[model samples]
Target chain A: MTGPKPLSNLMEQFQKLPGIGRKTAERLAFHILKADIKDVARFAESLRDVKEKVSLCSVCGSLTELDPCAICSDPERNKGVICVVEEPHDVFAVERIGEFTGVYHVLMGVLSPLDGVGPEELRIGELVARVEKGGVDEVIVATNPNVEGEATGMYIAKILGGKNTLVTRIARGLPMGGDLEYADEVTLSKAIIGRLKM
Target chain B: MPLYESPAVVLRSMKLGDTDKIITFFTLYYGKLKAVAKGTTKPKSRFAGRVEPFVYCNMIAFGKEKADLLRLNSCDIIEPFGLVRGDFEKLKHAFVSAELVDICQKERDTNMEGFELLLAMWRRLSVEGDARKQDLLLRLFELKYMSTIGFHPFLKSCVDCGGDIIGPKAGFNAIKGGVVCHKCITSDPAASRVFVGSVKLMGKSLEMPFEKLDRLKADPGLQGDIDKIVAGFVKYHIRRNMRSERFLAL
Candidate 1:
């Protein structure tokens, strides 16, 4: 009550955003106060726009301004092949590659038992239903290369293993410019295991 | 101490900042400790796979004599136990192991027994990696951990009366530290009556070596009993519920 209510309120609002802890929120609130009225209005408008415009695609669970999302609705995208990824941001990475022509199924999360995330918490049931509808031939699990991500990929593989769907994981190996000498053993091993004929 | 090295298994890790992680480890020599992994969340991090839970890594950390946390300088993988990371069931049991070790281990104690038990479990899991065997291995580990921590249940006789307790007349009193005979049930009002088979199996399970767990003729019914009995004992002794147990509730 003693402090400026609007300034303190702005700090608390910034704290609600991801990665903005108390200290960072304080900095952000001060920065916003120091900025011109026009820039602050644009920032606030963008925040409101995100909440109003973005909704998850019912079929693939990817966040989008439109239902079914842009990728899911594309006729050029291969409907029979689906890339299962952990979050909506992962879709952006795959899109940036511009190599794959398949549609995606965003899992929204990986299986992280330590953090209490399990199969039920993800959008896996929707993925299975999509598979059961019968045309899907392959589900490419593009989960992160970390432990939880690998575990989630394996779990989804098991669920779809016997359902006539070909389950495959995204390859793990050296990056395009990664030095062999500096590479970790696991990555090197995976690179060896996933080697393709030259 | 100065720059030191030890083989460590990451217990669990949580985000420190947008680009860093605070990782807890159960080390080979230093027992349990936590360390900050700067820029670990970055795409080109050198510490990527080595800091994940259940990875046994040779780490060069900035350890101090009185500090609770060591700043991890660099780590090279010793044994990734990659199968455990890739397999769902194996991953679950591995998480349970890490959780138990993190909860049960004390910092700077440097006890080798706990470290050895966990190392053995991860080694076995990496090789065979069967779902059924993973279950057995975890139950065996719970009993082993209890014994190692001196919470080994009193199986041969009643905890209160020193009478030979077996069959339906036996009841486990967690607060009393073991089984109470039918007549001695008044000693601990919180004693939960369990099947004599479960009590006998817990005692028998303690005798079974880690490798021999897979060969044990365990049926679904007995496995269920072992699950219930062991969970009861662990929860009661730890005096708080563990988050990993519910995730592993197959």
Candidate 2:
């Protein structure tokens, strides 16, 4: 624990980050110490910039430096088809796939009532409002395939049921390349239930 | 290391660190306990679907001598209860049951009756198609759960004066933990009016077997009365509003 106050303070901050332990924090601090002053300044500046610049998009709720975010502002992307995800990071996950050319709506979180997360706590109302604004054709709920996620998708469907827009949940099944023998019963059942006609 | 294994229902889970989950389970043997499932956040982790809330599984966990949180070793699902989880209304009702157990039971306290009652409720919820029946079942589960934890509201006689609750003038007092006759209604200004029929319906629901629950009937008005009485009683006893209760209106 004995160290220069500044070094210790840097380590403490590193330890606050997800997955960083005391040893890792110490190593990171020492690495910063050994690095060039300019490099460290750039690193620190980038960190500060991230905090200062990143805010949720006004339209989609995804973390972005811009108000509407690039996807929301994009002329080519289909705003009519909105992909609803649980977190801003999820937007990146879908974006990585590069197949979907639709806009996104980040729920920011799932509906977990036991943890005291309810509809009001999430971005569900915003999603409904976006759908109600009129040109939207379909909403593809891409929440995780967990109980809370499934329930959230259902809740969204119910709220949007009367709207002219179509509400659909992403299909869940065995992973590609996953062996049927190793698949759990629930996954197997879901695969069967959601099976496609060959 | 002592390995504890039991059939348990996942009450809830919370994110731990970057990849781990702290899962609370209401086990048939252990009653209620929490364990950390390592690396469960990863998409392909073995615990992916197993650690989710409302999953019923045969869980194996190991504990240190003094540490309260056990390390979850493995789990095999007994029932995923996916049918209930897939329906928003049913899911809300199921979460209410799970939350009630989490709030009322203490860690590592074994209560077989309570555990069985919860399982029965989930089983009923997963298969029962009628929405009204589902509501009735949830109310019954709440009542049964309250009694299992020793908070059973006195519905038969007056909670205040031990007098017979004879007429429509009776009121259910949440503060006093039971029904009050017309004379004792003044004791608690907040007590809501309780019809004799609603009181009798709750009593019968408590005593009746799970299979025969459908045989008991209450019109929409009576159902509403029981709902209010149970909600108030539970709110007063639990000391905090359930998060899931709000979403039930949706």
Residue-pair clashes per candidate: 0, 0
> Candidate 1, residue B165: CA error in Å?
3.6
Give the alpha carbon lDDT tens digit for every residue of B9-124 in model 2.
Answer: 99998889888999999998888989999988775677877888888999999998557899999988999998887787788889888888999999988988999888888888
Q: What is the TM-score of chain B alone in each candidate?
A: 0.89, 0.94
lDDT of 2 at B200: 87
List runs of model 2 lying over 4 Å from the truth: B186-190
**Model 1 misplaced stretches (Cα beyond 4 Å):** A1-36, B1-4, B63-68, B166-169, B181-201, B204-217
Per-residue lDDT for A129-189 in model 1, tens only? 9999999999999998888788888888878888999999999888887788887777778
lDDT of each: 0.81, 0.87
DockQ comparisons of all candidates to the true complex: 0.54, 0.66
lDDT winner: 2
